[model samples]
Target: MTAVTAPEEVARIQGRVVRVLALGQVLGGVAFGATVSLGALLAADISGQESLSGFATASVTLGAALCAIPLARLAAARGRRTALTLGNLFALVGIAIVVTAAALRVFPLLLAGVVLIGAGNAGNLQSRFAATDLAAGERRGRDLGTVVWATTVGGVLGPLLLTPGEALGRLVGMPPLTGAYLFSIVAQAAALILYLVALRPDPLLLAQRISRDAAGGAAPPVDADRPLAARYAMFAVAASHVVMASVMAMTPVHLQHLAHAGHGGAAGANEAVTLLVGTTIALHVLGMYGLSPVFGWLADRWGRVAVVLLGQGVLACALLLATFGSDVQGIVIVALFLLGLGWSAATVAGAALLTESTPVDLRPRRQGIGDTLMTSSAAVGAVLAGVVLGQWGYGALALVALVLVALTTVLSPLARR
Candidate 1:
């Protein structure tokens, strides 16, 4: 890459590129977000299995957890563009695996593919940070939010594709719903192309140059190689993501059970379940991404720690509300909405903080580690939620959420500046 440009020139060029990248983020997120929800649905439908759906979902997170930190280090050493391009490639491979598994009716292979897709997700999850790398400090959150909002189009549209995907799959003699994976492959490939075309010089390199300039062009101090807190923010940032992810994975499954058992063996149970899953996916995606800019902005202005605490507080209230109405779909929707919103707040803020807290040299490493922790913990949570639901039911799970909320109170002080 080239040396730093003047601030004004940097602003002009970087501003335009970041906007383009934001659009790319939205496109990628739409595909990825939809897949997360739809993959679980497809796994359940094709395998004629229920409990195993969570395992499929967990596989993706497990892959992500395994790969996130290493990828971050790679991006830090190489460039964000390189890392992202690699991610898209992984997604393409994962898609092919899923497609093959579906054709052959191989559940284990399908799960492996799901894990690979999750590995791609680990890369996709870092897009907001890529956006932040070029931002003019104050606008970080707003920029991040804009990209997230872009997902609204794809996130909603992905699930809506299910009916058509299934029909198409049947026409092709593949398992019903396997067609969705085909769409994902196309979307993810397009995403890879978008990054290749738009992310010139890469935002991470630009940021490194900018930081170098700000440090009087001297070798910048490595802030990232500090204490454990500076290096990880493990207990706080990772925990927030885990909680958010765990709950998201649990949501559709909960609704599915309710529809099956409580809806009086409804004739439209399958469709209803699909719709509920889609709606919840849409809502959760909206919640997580819709207000991302606001959170990014707040992280820059008020400090990331404050945003983390705010998110935790909102999450606590939302979980409490969920406990009151386990029987109502609307209640679950609202609670999940709040959960998504809370997650967005904490994640965006926490991510920004992690970046800010670390030295440039260490930023990527720490980011990867932090994200891996978050994803791994979320994977565990997903599996646990499924087991809990199988044994204790949704109502009992709500109590567990309440306990999680209580623990957040203890952690709230940790979020203070």
Candidate 2:
């Protein structure tokens, strides 16, 4: 690879890289979506404590936070491919442990398994950044967004597999939620194989080589403003994620309560409740990933800061809806949708801004730091969400999320030069 400098060559490589990453994301997303859809329910069942439900999802986020630095360091030292492969392997192990734990009904084992599964999520999230590694500055957002958008396919389909997963579990003599993990295991394994085979010449390494060649084999000086901008981007992404995760983690429980109360009537009863919850989660995921390309385009055209602010506005509206319309099913659906959309916007914009602002040599580390902070914030929010929902109701949790969203909005202006 003789330092691919031609514009056409860069475009070609970027396209190829994006395609590979997108396909991998689809596979990984399916595995992640399936696991996450039932994570809380499974936790409640295994622990026999409704209050501990959020811990399942929180542990996943926590695992991601813990793995971020190590993965980033590995990417910096080895390559993105290696780091991602290792993450998937961790997830595979997690899936096995979760399956076994479910069979044995061990709560601690279940939590442990979920944490490792989160390592897989860490890899999936990092793939978006890898898409930008060889991209033209002008097209970075589009490339990144395209990869993000690819997740929509698997995300939407993952929840739909719930019934089938349960059936599969029964057929195999496994527990109810265990079937979803089986699907996850297969999906994750396929993703690992695809990445190992297809991602050649490593995008990050290639970009680094090109940079060295352009600078006559010398490294560029670090940008003084990059660190501050990165911090802003990190904060923006973290706040948005915290809001999304906090509300999303508890929505199933909320719906379950409504189901028990017969708010929607017991016409179809169990079947109706399952359909409602599954559809809501599916739509929420669609909102999270379906329109990523649009946000990406806006990020590239209108600018990253503008998009971050836009995401904050959407999030504020979502929080308000959740707070005021807590009793309405339609309102909750809309609120969750907006929550996902806001997250997509903020995440895409924040990630693009962070990538563009960071130094090449330091990009992986900064990206890791950003992800760690983002996921950890979400983890805390998730753990607290269970308590909040138990004590003050979903409305109060939304209000808390609103405050955080507002704080991000106030900080958005600082991200710009």
Candidate 3:
């Protein structure tokens, strides 16, 4: 007879797993936060074209899209430890390449490095799933949300580090915009080590083993019809992501443009612009991850479809504010914050829905595919957003993005309870 794990033992193991994953989120968030906040600015400076700035965000999302499936496959075959560590290792190398690219003034190389950083970002995305591996259905959202919330720490700190990171870089004669990434390298390396040493028993593998033991080495019964339900959840995740990416990716560029209209002052225009962008992005990121637990709880208590709709509603409000009020910095800041908050609610709820909707046997792979879809779609949205912003203006871009949120809402009928 297979020896079953005691319920208490399983709970204890899950608690430890959540704690470890939370720490990893904090570290991963910092690395990506710094890179993401500056990627567009760096690309613009290196390419000398504001129109190309959006490509930086696009590359990062594309890179994440590329890594998502492979990382999920690895987690299925090997374990979460291996997959996450590999992702962090990729980020570390990418950070170094980005610093080198900055010094060499190579736009292509910068993109290449940013893409690898995106691979690391994929690992961060997967970590939330990892948190759910041993979670009970009732607490799944809460556990996942806790890990997501942990990211608020590093994410907020990363953007705020712009000035200090820059000063440190200048002390070593590094390029103007490349200094923040120097700190990124250390953060990624630390995350790599954390996953390597701390994640014992491998949460996904352990969960699979427990399932087998419970089933006495036989396949667990699954509802043949419900696997298809994952499609709606995936769509919810993808729609929310693309909408958020389209607007958020261009905010920095928009702020930089505004700084020249007497907002940056007569002296130190670049510094003023950097600080302003940094603060705004920090707040935006704060909105993205800070209140995730609340969204997660709402997902658990309020029904998955309802919270997803709520997110779309919040997104619509944000788009309206941004569309009509792009000229006002305060309004723009508030809009960006709303943008992040909407993403948090939709993504957290949608992900939780995806978890319960799919068959256990196919969950990892399907979830990976979902992430790929989400990121790739966002990549397209971000790329197009750049064209729109470059040719027209920020307000036009927001108005265009609003249409997507409305469509997602209109299609809400597709998602079932």
Candidate 4:
């Protein structure tokens, strides 16, 4: 097949790829968002120990970290289509297992299922990279951000489904929490089908072909700056993720406690808490994805390092607010929103930097490695956040997250040329 070189032709293909990927993101995000929102609550209920709550979210992050390299290798060998489809399949099976585990009240089974769910997240994360495969450098961040923004639709919708999901569970005789997984199952299956059917003429393969043809079958020259830039990108993404996950993992449990204390013995107390938590989570999800396009544009316009630094600053401010405002509901909401925004800034900019800095032939491997590090860091934070929250309180956990944010700031200078 002739390699596509015309700018218009490239734009056409890129547009199609972005549209398909965005749609898939929306569908897949519903499942992921629902699962994450419920993960800690489910774990706490199942284990009967507040300290073990983080394990649920941690398992998902750990699973994603473990699957990153393997999925990247698979993409390299087969194609994006196959790798993404397989990842979703893993999540589908996982949701089923999670439902069964919930029914049986088995904690270990729940953890195992969540891990596989994390594998699906690995695939979702990688899909953003696929959007950039055929994009010009100037538009790379924008295209990728558009795909990221697409997640907002389902991400927001998923948490909002909490009440309905619970009702459905009661109607069907399933555990209340397991009802959300019913939505997850359908959403994941839809995403799997979308990838298999819509992602044709895979972007990575086409980009490779174009690269080879443009170079007359010779390899592109290596840039000395790439290795350093890639390293910085990994650090920025990972640090930002750690702060977000650590705080987010414990927020539900914190809210649960408040609900018990403030509304105990009141009629519809459970429903009231569910509404509040679901809204908070939905808004958080919106903050994570809603403004990605703006961040993407800023990354391209101001440069990647600038965006990363800006994200670190935002995160620092967020942590401070959380630290002092733990008992204030409005303050906590704003802080979580800022937390999501900071994560978005760092992640979008960092990912674009990594893509531009890496050699085309080595892109998949490097991207995988970067994702592994990022998710692994978040997993550690998630696990520790539980202990910190249980022992010290949410204020202390936010302080710890603040330290990591500061470390990212210290590393920002290294990312500069």
Candidate 5:
């Protein structure tokens, strides 16, 4: 094993690793943005039912949930490089399949492809953890936050590309909505290259080596195979995601409904609705990743559980706003932004805490499990959001979800110690 004992060398390598991972996030996140923005429209069109539209996003989250453990295991066995590459590979295949599914108008095939794309999402999610592989105690949250922030650029750009992607598709005789995913293909490919070439010294492997060295060359303990603090981190992370996903998965639909209602349900207003929804989602994506650094710094300066509690507070604010103002376009837009920001605060802090709570040897495995739980729970929420939105309305859905936010808020304080 490569000896990575020196603090300076580890920090230097960490800088490089973070840079690579950040850039990878920029590229990889595009796929998710493209899929999320277009996936719902495509699902409704393909299935001839609006209720199934949210399932499109749900599939992506489900895919990520499924890939979490396996990719974590790969990181445990080979390294982060291999696991990320495999993730990109799945995304690449998924992109092609989605386009094909679009051509055939096959909803199931489209879901299958979206699910594979989730593998890439899982990799992107895991990259935040990779940032901590060589992170110093104080700067762990900062380093992780930097990588998280990089996604803002790609995510915003991905949705913006919807117009041109469709143009490109029209020029090439491709299916209508499938063209935007072409950008996803290129972005993911570039990310795959970045990971394979730039992420040198495999941050996880290096951290493992350094941990062994610190422990006199003996493997670290698992602490009775229990990671209590990790459980709190997972709950915080999962809780934040569930609320975020439930609302976000349906935001576009809600906006579209408002647009149609205003225009008397005229089909001619589809373009206007698209523009509004796209802009709202773009701003929301910005909220998700834009202020990560500030939160990360705060988590380091303040306390992890404190930041988590603050996140719950923000989420509560968002849920209430979304509940009462569902019909108002401007209020919904602001609420979506707040929703993204709250998720960012909770997840960023929750992740840093997860890293701090576990032993080095047990980090990867436990993190994977945490992510699996996080994504899985969010997937369920996303699915339920669809049903609730279909049967009741957006306000009712948001009101119903307040219970989740309250639960997380009440329990997170107990883990402060």
Candidate 6:
């Protein structure tokens, strides 16, 4: 008879494996965060059309929506390696298109390029799934959380690059902001290389194979038709993401209008706007990604539904705070901070919930559909934010956000139990 491995031995090996996967994910997160946070800003500079910025932003999210499901299916049918490699290739192609668009100064072509880049964003979203595959029952949250924290590092660096990127863009015969795209290319390429070299055996496949071997070749698939609570949890999680994305995307513009209206100050309008936008962006990012590990750990212990409800409540309060003090600088900062934190809670918890609620074969399908909804909804919200903010002013936008929060709050209790 074959010798049985000790539980401790198995755990040690798994830990090592999980670390490798997390490290790769962290690198990927940095690239993903850096590109997304600044894409709109860059688009504005290149196109010289402020309104088109939203379209550029939408293209990336739309690309994610359009391709996330297809990519998931590809992963399910082929394997993780093929899907990720394909995503990297698509990103590369997108970058090339973006570079060409910048050189040619074509607005529509630039939007098209961003769409291709967005397809890559879909792949990055699925990276969380790979991290989860290496984790044990409740530890899924913690693993996913670590990867998000990695994103904060890259995200912090992305905006700071604008100073130097502008100079580089001038040298390259493109606009000042175009240099950031070059950095994106380098960062994404590095991520692609790391994924190809380090992510071996494919965690999803490994998890499945291990379970099968452990079960003597007869283990049931993870999903096998989940319970009603699981389905509800999925929707709640998805809803949280929708709210977070929709609101967060419009914040920078909100800061601009508030500043222009003599709310922030008169002397340093531009600088003040930059600081507000950058600071809020940082906080929003921190809130959305920083506490992922803790929430992930909590999901493992407290139950996904409970965390999901708590997150929704937190987000509701954030919306209310933002609405009441839409014009105050300090208040807006606090509100955005809370908003980011709330998003982080819901996003991490929701992801864990989704993973737990569904089985292996169904993972790609469920995750793809759920994320597609989340990204697409956010895209719609972004486009709407542009129009609404222009028409009704920031106060009205805050009120709208309040309505969303209320809607989520009403559903929170129903979601929990």
Top TM-score prediction, candidate number: 4
How do the predictions measure up, each by TM-score?
A: 0.90, 0.96, 0.96, 0.97, 0.96, 0.87
Angstrom error of the Cα, residue 269, model 6: value is 5.6
Every candidate's lDDT:
0.73, 0.86, 0.87, 0.88, 0.87, 0.68
Error of 2 at 345 (Å): 0.4
Off by over 4 Å in 3: 1-4, 216-225
lDDT of 5 by residue, 1-417 (tens): 558687777778999999999999999778778888888888888998888888888898899999999999999888899999999999999889999999999989999998998877887788999998789879999999999999999988888888778889889999977788888989999999989999898999888877767766433332233366678889989989989988998888888889988999777677767678778888889989999988999999997888888888888899899999998999999998999899999999999999988877898898999999988888888888889999999999889878988898878755755
lDDT of 4 at 295: 94
Off by over 4 Å in 2: 216-225, 263-270
Question: What would you estimate as the lDDT of candidate 6?
Answer: 0.68
Model 4 TM: 0.97
List model 2 lDDT by residue over 1-417, tens digit each. 466666567678778889999999888888888776788888988898878889988989999999998998898888889989999999999988888888899999999999999887887788999998887777888899999999998888888787788788889898776676677788889999988998987888877776666656333333344777789999999999999999998888787777767745666655555566777888999999999999999999999989999999999999999999987888998999999999999999999999989867788989999999999988889999999998999999999888888899887767875
Evaluation by lDDT, superior candidate among 2 and 5: 5
Q: Could you give me the TM-score of model 2 versus the true structure?
A: 0.96
Better candidate by lDDT, 1 or 4: 4
RMSD of each: 2.8, 2.2, 2.0, 1.8, 2.1, 3.5
Clash count, predicted structure 4: 0
What digit string (tens of lDDT, one per residue) describes model 1 on residues 1-417? Answer: 556656676667667766766766666765675567766665666567666667777888898998898789889888888888888888889888887887787888888888888899888877867776766656666666666556656766676666666677778776655665667777888889988887886778877876776656433333444344443345566676767666677678788887788667879887777778777777877787777777777867887667877888888777776667777888888888888888888777777666656666566777787878888877887778777767776667656865655565566554443
Question: In model 5, which runs have C-alpha deviations exceeding 4 angstroms?
Answer: 216-226
Residue 9 accuracy (lDDT) in model 4: 81
**Is 1 or 4 the stronger prediction by TM-score?**
4
Model 1 residue 20 CA deviation in Å: 2.9
